[model samples]
Target: MTESPVLMSVDDRGIATATLNRPALGNAYNGEMLDALIEGIPRLAADPAIRGLVIRGAGKHFQAGADIHWLSAAAAAPPEQAFASSLQTTRAMQLLNEFPKPSFAVIHGACFGGGTGIACCVDVALATTQASFGITEVRVGVAPTPISTHMVHAMGLRHARRYAITGERFGPEEAMRIGLVHEVHAPEAVEARLEEIVAAMLLSSPAAIAVTKTSLLESNGLALSAHQVTQLTNESWMVRAGKEGKEGLAAFREKRKPAWA
Candidate 1:
């Protein structure tokens, strides 16, 4: 039997962990993974026994972004399916960004595209010193619209504009400097640090934490509306099915510069 794309568990202490499980693909997301997150986050959120959530990726890399082959296939899919694909991506990010409980991301290895988006949405992001970060959707000619809002919220507009457009890879320190991550530690110490943080989170009032988080996002206009998500999803799917998206994916697979480059 095939293993699930996402593995989720809650410990006796009521701390939940969601692991992106496609190690063979560097945890690059596909529809199954996105749907798992779309379904799982809310279930966990509604559980009174669950105090907080932690996001992580299994194996050598955290998440390398969407699987390119999947992107190519989605681009060729029927319009409704393609549109829904983009919607899944957009909705998953929005759910995490607005999750009711305190949430944390423990990042290591490669973190790109949607991975960076996950980092952006979490209340706390802890990365290993050796982790690499990038908002690289543009490299494949697909707009990073799904992640754009969170990127701007996590890092400032100036920083998000540069990285999302350029698709440059930066190290953990640079990630911290840009406000994408809260702390960077040696790989061996990162898990320890996360345990410390989660313990601290558990000590706080869960209801108060939820209230404060909601207020902060609403006051700053970080709360996303359904129409906004639809607009983003439309832009994302339109580009994936366009000429530039086709050429870009081809160039990447062929290991060559795109025509525009």
Candidate 2:
């Protein structure tokens, strides 16, 4: 039998961890892992015993973003069906971003694409100095719509525009400079900071943490409604079904510069 696409665990201390489990692919996302995240995150949020959450990727790299092959196939398939399927990733991000309680990410290796989105959704994102990051969707011709709002919220419009459009790879310090990450440390020190933060949350009042998180989202207008979800999904689908998305995916698989490039 195949291993589960995502692995989740909650400790007696109430620190819950959701790990993306596709290491052979640098923890890149496919449909099954996206589905697992959409299902797993909210279920953990609803559990009263859970006091905090951490998102990580298994093996070396964090998450490298959507599976390029998946996008290649998606771009070639029926638009509506492909869009709906891709929306599972959006749903997963929304659920985690809106999850109540303190959350953190211990990022290392390659935290690109959806990995950056996952980092943004958490309350605190700490990374190793060796870590690398990117908002890489445009490199392959697909829209980064699914994580756009969160990216903008985390990095602000100026930074998001520069990196999102360029799809350049950056180190953790650059990520911190742009506000995509909170703190940077040596690989050995990152886990200690993460554990310290989780421990601090464990000592706090759960009700207060939840209320504060809710109020923050509300105050910033980061919270979403059902209509917004559909709208974003539509935007994502349109881009993926467009000429650029097709060309980008093909070029990636074919290992060539896209025609426009």
Candidate 3:
């Protein structure tokens, strides 16, 4: 049997860690990875023992985003299959965003495309000084449909619109300036800061924290009902399976500008 594509472990303190294990591919996400994340996050969230969650990559890069090879193949897949893949990723992000406990992303190296989406969904996103980020879907002639909501939530609509359109990479300082990251630290300091934040979270009442999160989302007009989230995720998948998405994936693989450009 193939080894699992994602890994989850929890400490005695109810601190859960979710690692993206596809290091060889710079942690690029595929269908299997998405399914794993979608399934794992809720399980962790529902666990009374899990007080906090931390998301990270297995290797140097945080996440390079969607697997281009998978995306290329997905472009030619049946519409249903292709759309299902997109929905899986969208669902994973939603799960993290709506998780009751405090969620954090410990980012280093490249955090691009869907990676940015994941980081955006977390309540606290801390990046090493060397970390870089971008919403690069437009470069390949596709849209960041699924991640757009989280991106706007993290960086505001104005910044999201500019960066999503430009697909330009930015460093940790820029990310903080643009409101994408909560803090920037040395690589060695990431774990320390994460611990500090997690400790702070633990001091608050768990139930109260969850309720506060709900109130905050509602205040920001981001509290999506279950049905609304499902519907929006489905729409994201539809776009990813369409002509523009196919062309975008093809363009990236071919190392050429998309025809739409």
Candidate 4:
């Protein structure tokens, strides 16, 4: 497979790996990276040979969330343009959450904001003991609107309400305890756990797994309506560009806690 900046590769064993390649920035999300994931996910989901999907970061962190530079730019954009950009990331996470095959996230180091959103959407989430998580948008004066659905689904409304409002960073064990992650392993053991999950996924019939996942989503009422998803996305961007959002972003950039804290 051709290696794009945002790497995507599929093995004959039917397991596909999508690695966020910008390790220098802790694999932060930008328009290009978001576009790559948005385009790649549906393609992989459509492939007959691909039975499982794995998402990881190439270096120390899974993802530090949105790139600060990008955030700053988005903050300066017109409301409509900013909302459109924000929705792209939201839609990508939604797609992964609703994907037919089993999806897994191998998380380590920092997984915050959008990164946490991505991990929450996966079927199986494994994190290194050193991993840190937060719904950090609040610190930057933005609501966790885009990721609120998945956050609530993974960690429940009570937990989401606290973390989303506080933007507190929690460790991997706490994440597992709160039902955000399935397992907490040593950093070195992450790959081994991923292999185990892949092997287990392969043992089941693909069609059955897909149908079961669909049934479970329906039964649990976890699926989002199109209008709801759009509304959330719009709300997230709107808040980010508002006065409170600006204060939060400025406080973070200046390395100080927000006034609300």
- For model 3, the superposed segments whose C-alpha errors exceed 4 Å read 226-231
Estimate candidate 1's alpha-carbon lDDT, on a 0 to 1 scale. Answer: 0.95
Q: Name the candidate that leads on lDDT.
A: 1
Give every collision pair in model 1. Answer: none
Cα lDDT of model 3 by residue, 35-77, tens digit: 8988888888788888998989988899998899887776677
Candidate 3: what lDDT?
Answer: 0.86
Ten residues in sequence with the least summed lDDT for candidate 2: 79-88
lDDT of 4 by residue, 35-99 (tens): 99889988988988998998999888999988877887787799888988888888888888989
Spell out the clash pairs found in candidate 3.
Answer: none
Per-model TM-score, in order, reads 0.98, 0.97, 0.94, 0.95
Q: Candidate 4: worst 10 consecutive residues by lDDT? A: 1-10
Residue 2 in model 2: shift from native, Å? 0.6
What are the per-residue Cα lDDT tens digits for candidate 2 across 1-261? 999989888888888888889999999998899899888887888999888888888999888898888877778889778877668878888988999878888898998888999988889999999899999988888778788999999999999999999999999999999999999999888888888877777788999989999999988889977888888888887888889989988888899999999
Residue pairs of candidate 2 with colliding backbone atoms: none
Give the Cα-based TM-score of candidate 4 against the true structure. Answer: 0.95
Residue 222's lDDT in candidate 1: 94
